[model samples]
Target: MTDEEPPAARRGPTWLIVVVVAAALAVCCCSGVIGLTVAGSAGLLGR
Candidate 1:
């Protein structure tokens, strides 16, 4: 109800936060892999 309250108490749910963070991390990892693959191919192609 107030700033003095712990963040968890004021927030809705821990599992929801966990799920969102996990999904974000998965996206970042997948994107990073795709980027690396593209870069590697580009290097081979000298582009």
Candidate 2:
């Protein structure tokens, strides 16, 4: 039997995937905070 290296297609870059996921999380968190702020100001939070 011969041992050969895998193709590049099967070993894609992971940094790109990590960056995309991090950016998505940041956007979601920021939007949630902004929404709460707006709701509080409008007296929609029952405060």
Candidate 3:
């Protein structure tokens, strides 16, 4: 075989896909909290 180099390493682990998805879901859930906080001061939504 030739002396060609292999591809570079990934930034994260492959098995962490589940964890990554869960983390993304957690962020989405937290976004609703942020929206609530922003609108809470404006009295758009109930506390």
All candidates: CA RMSD in angstroms?
Answer: 5.2, 3.8, 5.8
- The C-alpha TM-scores of every prediction are 0.64, 0.73, 0.55
Residue-level lDDT for 33 in candidate 2:
100
Worst 10 residues of 1 by lDDT: 3-12
Regions of model 1 farther than 4 Å from truth:
1-12, 44-47
For residue 7, what is the lDDT in candidate 3? 22
Candidate with maximal TM-score? 2
Which candidate should be chosen as best, given lDDT against the real structure?
1
Candidate 2 residues 1-47, lDDT tens each? 13344444444656668888999999999999999999999999999
Select the stronger candidate by TM-score from 1 and 3.
Answer: 1
Model 1 TM-score is: 0.64
Model 2 misplaced stretches (Cα beyond 4 Å) = 1-12
- Backbone clashes in each candidate structure, one number apiece? 0, 0, 0
Residue range 1-47, candidate 1, lDDT tens digits: 67657786646678788889999999999999998889888895465
RMSD of 1: 5.2
**Per-residue lDDT value at 2 in model 3:** 39
Worst 10 residues of 2 by lDDT: 1-10
Off by over 4 Å in 3: 1-14
Clashing pairs in 3: none
Quote the positional error of residue 2 for candidate 1 in Å: 20
